[model samples]
Target: MTLALVEPTVDLYGAWWEAHEEWGPGLHEDGFGLAAGDEVDSPAGFTAWVERVKAEDSTCRWIVEDGQVQGGIALRHQLNEATGHIGYGVRPSARGRGLATWALGEMLNEARALGIGRVLLVCVADNEGSLRTIERNGGVLEGIRGDARRYWIELPAAGESGVLTEKGADG
Candidate 1:
């Protein structure tokens, strides 16, 4: 399994539409912020949307396994001054497999590479799984926002121990 930037193509768009049909309407990662009803139903439109994401100030990537898109992670920089915000979701079929936790680790690596020192994550207060995933990735509870919980994960410098890295006893 690998985390890859989603490429706009007919195959991917078709698969997404199929998932939408089966799972009901929700965030589609590719065209984040756009209602599912507004999602382009054409390959060309989907490609154009992807180009927009590449041309935008944020970055989004997908969790791919065996040629299937299991989930996605998106990052927005400069939020709250010196912090990047993370948004992620896993497909229902891919739930309960630790994919979100692993993906969060990878996203933090991306953040470090881009000089991001701290990341903010907000999840529904009752989302136990999501809360655990954030905690596992080193997020510390900062506070709560309405029905959401806010957490912050400070990126570690190389050689510094943090929840982002796992080591065996021999290390």
Candidate 2:
């Protein structure tokens, strides 16, 4: 299947909402940058949210496959100890196709383009899919804090090989 990471736009509203509804009611969708007060159900509110998340500090992209919204991924320009520098998620119906892995690899490329040498990614310890996705992209286990598993991924510099290794997987 062909997958494209594109900017969030109103044109995909229906498709996005279908994926959003499948995820049900929760802020855990990740990468869409949903806020507590934002009303994504309405056109005006979604429009506002789209504008807000596209700010200079962050980059958000929707994962579109075969003209449908499958998931989303975001790269934060500034690193936060709690949330890390990148976040992403694939819709429930679209799982198991390696979409998250592909999106993450693309986001890592974006991070490298921005001069970020390394990034921290955290996921629940029980989330095997997310854990594997991160690891496939070179994420090294830093430690487990409570229910969160923190990892650090070091990006290869320009002209270096992009192949990810399991060098620090035991960490």
Candidate 3:
């Protein structure tokens, strides 16, 4: 079970779209609707979104596996001057492979080095795997906002030990 995380490129986006079309829809019943008629769905929106995220602060798009994309994860930084948080996510087929845990661990380490103080991850109430990923990364459940469960992992204050050391069971 070897895997690597690569940045999201145009080619990666295409692979993700194909995988989503094949295995994403109905995986969770009516949770995430599949792209209808090849219209503007989550993947398409995500492709454009990642580009926009790249324009600001920094955007990380990762492809899992030696050559297969599997899925992508990203850290979209918040730029509110007072808040330097990062938001992230992984693709469907790539979910249960610990890719999220690895990507997140890498992101947190990178964030710490970049002077970031915290990372935030949010998921729907029913997204158990995502919730577990965040928790394994030392994310503190910070209550819910509407339908989303917000979690936070405060980077070790300067000179403190980093919290996330072990990957989750899924990985």
Candidate 4:
């Protein structure tokens, strides 16, 4: 089904949200519904959210396993210094499977494909798992924001460092 239909249809995004709502709105962020219809109720509200969020060079996707949502990833284009803001989360049941790490890699490839040269990924310091995942992906420590730690993952470019070579080589 098309993405537009998913949010408004109970059969598609509804079931996924029912199962994973505990992840919080901050997880799926969807690039849409950030301001309008944060609670995704009415079909009209969902449609409005979609229309208002048609920003250029940005995207979000859910990771599915056995037809169920396991995680989600998103990139906010040029959130800062020409770097995309990368964010992701794996469902509670999907934890410990390295799915977040894998998902981040996929999002990185998506960013590179869009000509993104770097991404800033921030997570809570208490999230040891996330810190590990970012480090494994060549994310360099940037700074700390309250309880969050910021990292910059460099993608391969004509003159930039090849920190993301692992994926860029094949991406």
Candidate 5:
């Protein structure tokens, strides 16, 4: 299956909604940049949200496979103490396929391109999948704050090799 990270576009509205619905109702979709007041249920609202995230201080990309939205990943240009510098999520159906790991690795390159020397990623303590994904991308456990486990990854300089060279299912 060919996978790609692409900018959010209205053309993928239906595909995005399919993945969004699988996530259920909430603003908990990491990397989606969904706000409490944003209305993504309507065409205009969705378009506006797309524009907002694209114009924001972050980079958002939808994970697409075979022309369907499988998940999302975002690299925050600014370092957020609470949320960290990167966030991502895969649709429930898309889990276990290493999509998150692949996307995170890709975003790490983006972070490096932005001249970020290091990045932080936080995931729930009990989220084994997330833990593995982060670890696979060279995340070093910093500590646990409350229920969240914080990790820091030192990015390689531009042109250096990355941790992941090809996509595969989560091992």
Candidate 6:
């Protein structure tokens, strides 16, 4: 499996749409808020949200396996004066193959380089796979949100680690 992060482009709109349409409803009540598309309602909202995330710093997608965009994860920077962190996620079907674990590790590797101190991730209460993925990535369960479980993974205070470099872009 090859894994690499890239920016969103028009070319991705189609696959993103298909992935979002299929996973949206089952993933959250705010289906429109979560899916990726061009409509001002569902996918548009995601685009706008992603843009905001970019403004804070940078955004990226984690593509895994055979150069296919099977799933993606974004590292959204938090600008709150009190806390500096990154947020991320992966596609639904890509859940079982340890992609999330790999993606989260890569995100944190990037975060550490970007001077981000903490990484936060949340999963729906029933998303057992996600919970396991997060735990595998060294996430510490913080608490529960309305219907989600929150976690925090602290990046090493300093020093470069061989974590992200081990996996080439072809995973």
Q: How does candidate 1 score on lDDT?
A: 0.70
Relative to the true structure, candidate 6 has a C-alpha RMSD (angstroms) of: 8.3
Q: Of 3 and 5, which scores higher on TM-score?
A: 5
Tens digits of per-residue lDDT, candidate 2, 1-171, equal 778999999888999999999999989888888989889999998888888888648889999999899999989989988889999999998999999999999999999999999999988899999999999888989999999999999988999986765779747
lDDT for each residue of candidate 1 in 49-155, tens digit (9 for 90 to 100): 66666565666776677677677677776564322388777777777899889888887887887888888888888989889999999898998877788899999
Candidate achieving the largest TM-score: 2
Ranking by lDDT: 5, 2, 1, 4, 3, 6
Off by over 4 Å in 2: 162-171
TM-score of each: 0.79, 0.92, 0.66, 0.70, 0.92, 0.65
Quote the positional error of residue 49 for candidate 2 in Å.
0.8
For residue 99, give model 6's deviation from the true position in Å: 0.9
Stretches of candidate 5 off by over 4 Å are 159-171
Q: How many backbone clashes does candidate 6 have?
A: 7
lDDT by residue (tens digit), candidate 5, 1-171: 999999999999999999999999998889888889999999999999899999999999999999999998999999999989999999999999899999998999899989999999999999999999999999989999999999999887877765544446544
Alpha-carbon shift of residue 146 in model 6 (angstroms) = 4.2
Residue clash pairs of candidate 1? none
Compute the lDDT for candidate 3. 0.61
Candidate 4 lDDT over 1-171, as tens digits, reads 212112222344555565457666453433222553344556655445444444445676666666666666667766753223876666677678877787788778878888888788888779898899899888999988778788988888656556344546875
Assess the local accuracy of residue 162 in candidate 6 as a C-alpha lDDT between 0 and 100: 30
Displacement of residue 104 (Cα, Å) in model 1 is 0.7
lDDT for position 158 in model 2: 90
- Residue pairs with backbone overlap in model 3: 6-63, 8-61, 98-171
